[model samples]
Target: MPLFVKDFSWEQTDKVVFITVPLKGVKASNVDIFSSEEYLKVSFPPYLFECFLYDTVEDTDSVAQVGNGTVVFKVLKKEPGKWPQLQSDVIDNKEAMKVKRTEAFAKAEEKLKEQSKLKAEQKRANEQYALKEIMKAEEEERNRIERVKQSERQKATEELEKWKEEQRLAAEKEKERLMEERRKEEAAEREARKEQEKILKRQTRGKKANIFEQNAEGAPKREVGKISVSFTHRQFPTPERESVKPKEEEWLKKQAEARRIVELEDENLSEEEKNPMWLRDKGNEFFKAGNLEAAINAYSHALRLNHTLHSCYSNRAACHLKMRNFFKCIEDCTRALELLVPPVPQNADSRVKCHVRKGTAFCQLEMYVEGLQDYEAALKIDPNNQQIKDDAEKIRHLIQTETVE
Candidate 1:
């Protein structure tokens, strides 16, 4: 053993492990440091201090600094982390090996802990970054949808105006045609009357009627007087047809239409084609075609036939959603949920769909809390459904943003 080290203090930092040996009278140029894979030696003026390394150290990375009556040796660790002890206590070969092994394991564990902490921090940062990116994408999508809807509204307004102008022109043309037809009929009737009068004049050369009158002899006397039936001052309806009216004013006489009345008794039919199922299917078709009013009517008819029909109410709720009838959508969804609470349709997915749709409708109406509640309830029904989770996440974000506002 070397007695050169009077007392030593060892410390470690993020980048380097430092061991300070206090030498009271020793000066520079007299200290020599020797480094090896498993040993470190310091010789200062006829005395030598040496110890076996606890773990691997970079020999070239060693530096010696002298300040304030102390000599400090800072050696960079081969791996960046903590060490349980700076060097193994050189007691004996077997005991020394045991200490070194334990120290090595301790160093390895400390490095592993640091690496684990770093990985955790990185994972959290990555999650935050991904969340930010998702929120940004959602915002962009919403903005794009708003722009598209605005453009569509403007286009629809322009198209409506153009249609109105076209309808006005068509009505005017139709009015003119009716007026000409009326004029032709009146002229024909007048011409026919004139020909009839001419024929009547030829039939009776001088028109007269006879009446019996009393004479002075009180005998029968025949008296005649001329009379003419003239239509000189008669006028036909040559006035113009009424001004062009709106299309709504055009009345068509109701004629019997067979298609308007369905005869269910027709021979060529299946049993399933005449019932609520058929009506429900028909309503679905109407809904898909964008005939919301007809869909509503068909759904109503089906409900009347079978009040407990499984999906009609839900389908009707979808119709209301498309119509922007948010309240009605909520109502229909509630009804469907009531029917589907015990898993009536035996399709949990259908129930989940209803919940999500109703929640979305509530969100559309700006009832955020209700929407959030719905989403949470749906998650309880189907905890692992990814779509429901996503919807719930969206609702939570909306709530958070609204709270910020």
Candidate 2:
């Protein structure tokens, strides 16, 4: 049983009541205070104080200060008035006061629970709003990038059309120039041939009249001989048969059969089920539903269909991390990072996620040095991320502490 604190003094105004209680030698840290609409309690080890007020006071507006071997309360009154006495009607009844104290404690706990629930709801609402804003911003950014790409593509197409038109005009001009040059050459050749015929006619008129007349008659008597034509036979050189033909044919047949089986299996799947993107979306749904195994299976199927899908690897790595398969997490994160090649702005966030996930796996495996390197790499990609910076700082601190130990 605690000694009752009876030396406390209090004063009352029309709207407020001030109570001062001395610690008598107890430290301020050891004091505990509770207040309600009509009850007040101050407790320290070996000391206890209780008051059932004459009227209800505004507990929400009440304030208590503890320091310097004393506790003072500035309690607001519910109604502006002076009371007949500080204590309530049950001041001398110990059992009644005890019951009042218990009820007040229960009410305080209930109020605290209500406040906590309200705060949690508010926090969830705020987080949802923030997520919405982030998604909206990302969508707008993608739209802007697409519009810019469209504009650039249109400009390139126009430039290509212009280049083709220029080439066509140049080709036409070259054809016309070549044709004109050929016509000029042909006319020159005709004139040269006419000149040569005139020269021949002049020479023949002077000298060949007597000599060619007898020679033309004499040259007609010559014999015609027949010649036989024959073609050489052509044959293709065959390649050397290094292996047995029957066994090679059998191997080829087996390969074809295996290929047919694979095709048949693929044909059994629906178009949506066959799509890697669809499987990835399904995996995301499973992940949100907290079905890690289902999510991993979905991601694995998606990866099989499209091995280059970095998001699937990254998502599967997340599932592995949650399942505490740290080695698998590291492997998936590494594969995802490899697939996210060239490090463009579009894949920057994915790269950062992979690096951070791998870093987390490394840290979980107590490979702090490797984990720190990955975290630093992630920081380089997302320098403005305060959360990553804080995490890196924590890892560094942990490493230092471990080293010292």
Candidate 3:
């Protein structure tokens, strides 16, 4: 039971029609406008305005502007001709106008559904295209990284071979120098022995000449001498020695404890296999064979026997990394690094491995900055490692890309 808006105005040209409706105090957001080839309707809560046009118009090309408490519509006519009136004569026939309104509303709803469907299809297509582009970019990046890795590995291998050749040559030179020095020393010793023999012969001849005089002097010097010897004073009749009794007892105690622990942990282990070094070797074999669980168990057993085994922790971290347990890998790497203290040449390689492994885990977790720091630390330890340098540079580029985005 909405009231009809009767004060609307309209004008027409040969090819177009203009309609303006006063919205009174109605807001634009509350207005609803719908149009078809022959009918147009505008609803604003209690007010409604509609028209069955005098002639067919192009609703597809129709446009509406709403502002300042008014709505303006510009509709195109199907035929380029003047109209006698804005609305048709059926406006006075309630039944006919009602039927027309229902038909027009249904046509407008169908058109809206088709447009919405088309828009959805277009949006879906765009998203799929974007996804494909992203995947392609990722694939290209992976290929580039693989190529770089292969090149670096080849270069490192060549450098290692050249270094080994240089070492072999230098060792040969050192060996020849040592052999020549030894020969010179042997010749000098032979000459000294010959000279000593000549001196001894000359001395013997002189002694023969002085034999009569010496016998006379010896006869005068036939006196005996007595020598007194004293032993070190001690309350106990035992030889003196530094006291190491307590140290020996402590070492024996630790050995006994280690044996007890090993026996209790695994009765199947033989006496030879109970050693920590044996267990570590077993772990290495298991790791090389790709038995990660067995390797981890072996490494764990070795660590239990000897907690200071940094190599066991480092190797276990490698296993964890292969298993994609990144957090566990980082933990093992950290533990290994802690055990590899003082930064000695003997432990330099182990330190570098731990740093690189931990960095890899960090990068897997998307903590690029932390990963970069660890890689840099590894590079400091092994400055000649081109692989680590390249990896660090890639991470830096990723960080930059993310930051820019």
Candidate 4:
């Protein structure tokens, strides 16, 4: 029997490449390999590598060459037991070979379909496995970050606790130090008070002893005297009485003449009976009577009449000072200074008096600088005046002390 290529080959003519027989003396019906023209024309799916040829003759030759001899063959209508089974001879039955070719092609196509399905299933499994691995790696990275953050939080908590403990200890130590300082201060104050009390008691005892000694030294002394007395009586004559009466009449006549002259002067007075110096005299009377308000009014009235009256303003300033109206005193003093004219050489005493009064008003107003200037000017004019000299010294001391401060 001759055998051909079971799978079709596009490059080979009539689906036969190099044919060979496995036996030589076999009948065509008993051969193991055979071929048909219809089988050569069949198309096989790509998965089928070979096909079986069956129900053919057996051969005795070890190998027989194809197309070497003519042999009659009939195709059998039977399915092969297995792929690659042998057939006896080549056949020319186109119908039966066509049916066998169709069955073989259907089997080859079924195997190809099964292989494609298995490959698709394997690809799906591989993708699922890759996805699972990626998810597991992401979870591990997240867990690692959480662990690092937890470690940092623990470190910060420990540090905070340590700082708080240090602060607590520092506060306790400071409190103890302050308490110790307060205790020492209280003890020092108590000792100082005791020393001050002892000094006061010693001073009181010394003052009492001095008073007793002064009284003993200034005591009064007494003296006694004796005297003798005598009495006499006499009668006076009428002629001696007449001589005494005439002397009395002569004294009365001189008094009457004096009275007549004062009457004549009164009758010759002017229409304005009031004196030009009335305001000043009335102000003086009020001052003597201790009526400071009336005295100031009278002095002011005198100034209104004659603005040049420096004495009235100065006297009114004195009254304002006595009433403790220091601002009013300063005003009056200022007015007096504006009205006062420079005095003649012989009237230096009056100028000095005015300056003293103005200085006293300045001191009352607490105008220390002006007050000291006035006192200095008054001392230059009347250095021997004790009151002016004392006032100038006092003002000088006040100015020096204030400047030092």
Q: Show how many residue pairs clash in every candidate, following the order shown.
A: 0, 0, 0, 22
State which candidate has the highest TM-score. Answer: 3
Score residue 192 of candidate 1 by CA lDDT. 78
lDDT of 3 by residue, 298-330 (tens): 988888777779999999999998886777899
Q: How far is 192's C-alpha from truth in model 4 (Å)?
A: 85
RMSD each, Å: 18.9, 24.1, 16.5, 45.6
lDDT of 1 by residue, 164-282 (tens): 79999999999999999999999998997788777766855664633454569987764333466954331233322433334223322111122322532446755654577888999
Could you give candidate 2's per-residue lDDT for residues 79-179 as a string of tens digits?
99998898899887889978888889899999999999999999999999999999999999999999986775566556547867999999999999999
Off by over 4 Å in 3: 27-29, 78-81, 92-95, 175-405
Clashes of 2: 0
Q: What is the lDDT of residue 133 in candidate 2?
A: 100
Candidate 4 wrong stretches, greater than 4 Å: 1-276
> How much is the lDDT of residue 76 in candidate 3?
97
**Which window of ten consecutive residues has the lowest lDDT sum in model 4?**
40-49
TM-score of decoy 4: 0.31
Clashing pairs in 3: none
| Candidate 4 structure quality by residue, lDDT tens digits, 1-405 | 323434332211222222332223333344334233223221122212223344422221112223322122233333323324343233456565556767656755675788789989988888999899999999998999889757755554565467679999999999999999999999988987787777666756646534334335686422222355864322333454355766666777677755654553455545332232687778988988999999987786555445567777778877877776655766777776666656566657656766777777666545678888888888888888898888788898998898999
